[model samples]
Target: MTSDAPAAADKRPRKADGDRLSKLARHKHIISQLTAAPTLRASELAAVLGVSGETIRRDLMELQEQKLINRTYGGASRPFALEPALTDRKAIMIAEREAMAAVIADLILPNEVLMLGAGATTFHIARRLASRAHDITVITHDYAIAAALAVNPSIRVLCCPGRYHPNEGYVFGTQTIANINSYEANRAIVSATGISARGANDADDEAGAIYGAMAKRAAEAILVADHSKFDQRALTVFAHWTDIDRLVTDRQPEGALATALRAAGTEIIVAQL
Candidate 1:
């Protein structure tokens, strides 16, 4: 009787926990989890949220209808995506970003010029270079990246001239593109909001334009992104796989993306955690 009572108590709905959360709050959590992982099973989500399996299924159904997630066999996956604000993104995947940054920084040689695009992962690379790289020039449209690279006295940082995007903390427009075109770089290190068989992509067209310009102007284009970006399709494909020289990421891309990279002859460098 005592054992049965304890088991019953354990099975009771956590009314003080997940039950108190609103549907909107649960949806937000579901999205957050999906962002950090490749896929989520319905059973795991039910256990974590302390909700009934049916409730979780209903939530997944609604999110799928809204195109927020891709429903899988008893699971969910990241959709062809949209990203949050830059500030919000900066807070996510810190360790993965830092690991990728380290690998990218090591690939850079002294006295080389690099074109950096605007994104949270690239920002982490900028910070890594500031501490480790030497005698390098970094040209970027992101004011924050320029400031980060400036901390290294040996690195020369140039900010592009263009209209400032208040929310993104970067410059973008005709001037930015022209300026990027004028400088030939040893390498371009950029981040994408998504990477699918279609190639590297961004959620914002203006940001995509900047990344595209950088890739064209540089001798080698290196894309630094973490695993969560895998299979995500975004608003614009900035650089085709053939245009990219190397990909620095925390995980090896599988499925169609791996096939595309192999076909395009782009090198994949998986950073050690």
Candidate 2:
């Protein structure tokens, strides 16, 4: 179906995400230039990106599957709750994911305990976290996180090991839960599969078990999502809004999101993109 040559090239060029930003930078540029910014018609994105509208639609579909952005009648828009896979959304979206991750990383304290989820965004957050010299303990289901933080005895980067999930980039199972329960982290820097009006957040598989357990074990739950996870539901619900003490998302959430979370008494912390 695909060529190994291009697939192999994907890894070579993406050392630290150098070329990953190429496609996403275009997407962000278009979004920034457009007006009446609610619904982005697929045709417009295609013209801007110099691709066919169908190609843009395909991109939108990829983003929708990950719940990073919402698809409307004609196009997609940034929703308040989403965990998109920029890796699959073309190289450009990976840049956007990394940008989003940088914003999410602000929630980390110098020496706080962090719980990271598995995905494109959290992977970038892991990279940023690696540079900081904090007595930090990163609890994660992501195999990447452990490997990234390995050899760094200064920051206790612990992985919640289980059945490895290739897609979400983590391992999940009872062992993951057990490791998560063992840690009493001060804060959890995590992501979700999706969100809904009723305040249910879900993820793929029972993989959310580690996410839920970490949130419950932590003193604070700092949900790091872009403005895309809103109004969607995944296979499993990690927790509800009441448990989400502080939410760190890109840009100030508006529209129904402002109404929805306020009604639930959840504190919204927006990062300037």
Candidate 3:
């Protein structure tokens, strides 16, 4: 009697058996797209990948479960919680931040008082200022920024007295706000976690309050944010577009965000990287 077992070749793994591997690849592609653009609609993703809507939805679910993306109403976006620590942020968008910092540095004229906010991008601006040999006064709440600029004898670094946040390496409190109110600066260069039609937002309340105080005390408030910050929303709206005189970014704003920025009369300077 002949055995009923199938042939060895027929029992071997086939292309259909690689569904798990294919799904993993698809998941990575979805994450990459989300990283490039803060938000991505499911329909657009499905069409672009030539996959069914149901498959896209399933992939999004898996990605969300893995904490690689945040599921929104009709799409997905990068997770928005607290802003990353300064050191962690220093490694992100380095090229864009450097270009933006250079642009901001050029905007600074010698002898003008400047207020710098606490953020990785602003820290880059502080480093840029360190390279300058001009005499200027700098007031900031970020300890890292103050330390970075301390090497410049021509620049005076003033630290705001407040409760220190060790994790962020910054000081922010009622005292910090009052200190910012006591002095006026020619320009305030600030960065935020997100920038949308709503406003320039921060992930922390204290930091957001400090940004508002700084912007309020400056003659001109310029916001420095990279392309990744667009279309994203954070916990706190620190300053409205009306409060900002200019925005220096790596890329041009698009859609509603672009329209809002134009309507607000905020001069947009796209840094050449």
Candidate 4:
């Protein structure tokens, strides 16, 4: 079966969605378009970018957060501030991530087998689960996640084999994907760099490949993403909305992304902060 947005290894592109550009690329395009006009409606950007109106709105929100654009009613205009690097938007939202982690930890049952992906938000989940969840076996490629879960004697931590990424502090490659595929988990809990109507995405290809493998190998897949990721697209579309059983987030997704998630039978769990 053809996946909605396959990993880079698969080399099979989803021809249906025209707005397949990464978030950073989209930001650049949006800025350029705004430069050409004083203001542009979300629908105009959506038509030009081949994405939904909701996605354009989300893009505008992200841009506004970065101080790159001024959001008007139904549209956006150029702002005076220069855009920052995409990866620079981090180290914040601690309270929100921890809240989502707490919610996920509550949902985790004893003796459950889980596949945990690497990311800041997922790391928070690991920390929360380590303190509360017992008798669960966690299989992960992230060294930090393994270390956090290892503190709980009741929980068993299994590490995957792969080349280590010094900066990201995780292991990812074909080996990691192969290792994840070797296990059958009760639930695969993964984090995303972005989540849109298309699916859960990651900025890194190797990490995304591992996430996709874990999702496919598990009985159920739970995606964890913060509000910042809402309506954002990334380099790798790891899992489609239909592949995800639940989405744990700090805020509820609105508009088109919300409708798409509902249509895909994805249950949204908003973490109370």
Candidate 5:
């Protein structure tokens, strides 16, 4: 005896199922956004996802628990990952760094005293300066920079004394800061892990301290960062945009970052690579 039934009407879609699917979709969208940018504010994400801030917070908590992202103050950031070592970084963006180095080299005058920071881009700048016939005195905490300029008889390299960080190929500590303060330079050329409206940032605390001291003692402070660094946040904010005299980068900064740099009165130099 077959009874024609509609299989219980396909068991009407469950409310919980729809809610779970929606939450899953939201998680995916959040991950995609974070993958594109290093960090995103909770409020921004909430608006984009058309959800309440509270909902976003809960989602962030779950994502953090899953080791998908890191929860920051009022925001979420990509999961913590160690920055690449200097040797690896040296090859990452050669063309852009070279162009930036050339621009920076043009700014230096013969016999001017310079303070150079430790990083791949700064290393390139040191190389460019070394190639010039100009006689300059350079005070630096980077072993690579010192070595790069060593062959140039026209350039005098003064190495800052401190504890050496192997991966960074540089020296940093209290001694480094003290050494930086001992002499005031005409210009300080530095690099950063990130730059945003908040400030110029670094991944290492000790290195940040050295950079800060150098910027303070120098007559002019120049920051060399790439377009990739714009709007990014690092572990330590070493200098604000107002503290920098010039910002030399591979591309022009856009959006809030550009506005903030302008408001801070930092001269922006876009290197034509």
Candidate 6:
């Protein structure tokens, strides 16, 4: 207050420091990652943190623990449970996920038996199929996917039996695996919870495990995921690059992933959006 002394201004706490909800709001943001796919590049995420890459990784671990979202290579995303949170995720990625699925369906041939996995993207693809073709047997563990084909008598639809996750709109469990194993699919179109540099498809929970089981029984494995899934590892890995027949995505997957998948002998098809 003296002329010789520098006057100190009153200090207020940052909103992040003052509001308990500031913490909860942080939790809410990870759900945004689910919607921000294809555009959420890992390198860009590391840049946003203002910390070293390693620090951001540790931060992601804490988010993963809250079950707000699963950890990805450079980010975090909403968990698979059906909830208002998932609905939020769905709204953001609608155009991109739809584009990726459109690219995947372009390769389908008539009279092929296909196993569709659970995820909003898969549900979108099934809807497209319902309009375009008939006499194709679609096998799936997802109620939403099965229902999309319900009125189509020409397309034979098989539903797997197991525990149904109402949030994910899919059936998954040992019973689901048993049902999936009973039939052989010509090609299996599935989605992933995340993709790792190791070129593996990872899932957030046990539902992922059942999808992996059915994928192995198919003659060809075609993964239908958008660019957002790249550079992340989930709770369980369903298949490796060596196991995948093709990767159908909205954009070309980048980073260590493109090389790893190619080296593993997997063909990547970038869907034209």
Who wins the TM-score comparison?
5
Task: Sort every candidate by TM-score, greatest first.
Answer: 5, 3, 1, 4, 6, 2
Off by over 4 Å in 4: 1-90
Checking candidate 2 for backbone clashes, the offending pairs are 23-92, 24-92, 79-227, 81-228, 81-229, 81-230, 82-228, 82-229, 195-232
What C-alpha lDDT values do all the predictions have?
A: 0.90, 0.66, 0.88, 0.84, 0.86, 0.72
lDDT: the better of candidates 1 and 3: 1
- TM-scores, all candidates, are 0.75, 0.63, 0.76, 0.71, 0.80, 0.70
User: What is the lDDT, from 0 to 100, of the residue 140 in candidate 6?
Assistant: 89
Q: Which stretches of candidate 3 lie over 4 Å from their true place?
A: 1-63, 68-82
Clashes of each: 0, 9, 0, 0, 0, 2
lDDT per residue for candidate 2 within 1-273, as digits (tens), equals 766664433221122455443556655554453322545787766664566787677777877776566788888775543344635632443555566666656556778877777766567677767765467777788777677766466788776668876765678888888888887888776777665545546546575666677779889876766666655555667777777887766657665556767887888865555
User: What is the model-wide C-alpha lDDT for candidate 1?
Assistant: 0.90
lDDT of 6 by residue, 48-80 (tens): 433356655655677678675666655555464
lDDT of 1 at 245: 94
Q: Where is the poorest 10-residue window by lDDT in model 6?
A: 12-21
What TM-score, to 2 decimals, does candidate 3 have? 0.76
Write candidate 3's Cα lDDT for 1-273 as tens digits. Answer: 888987565321224554333677778778777655778999987776667899989999988888788999888997764577778899989999999999988888989999999999998999998996379999999999999999999999999999999889999999999999999999999999999887799999899999999999999999999998887778899999999999999999997789889899999999999
Q: Give a tens-digit lDDT track for model 4, residues 181-219.
A: 778999999988788778988878888898988899889
Task: Give the range where candidate 2 is weakest over 10 consecutive residues by summed lDDT.
Answer: 6-15
Q: Which lDDT value does model 5 have at 28?
A: 83
Candidate 5: segments with Cα more than 4 A from true spot: 1-68, 72-82
**Candidate 4 least-lDDT 10 residues:** 80-89
Q: Please report, as a residue range, the 10-residue window in candidate 5 with the lowest summed lDDT.
A: 11-20
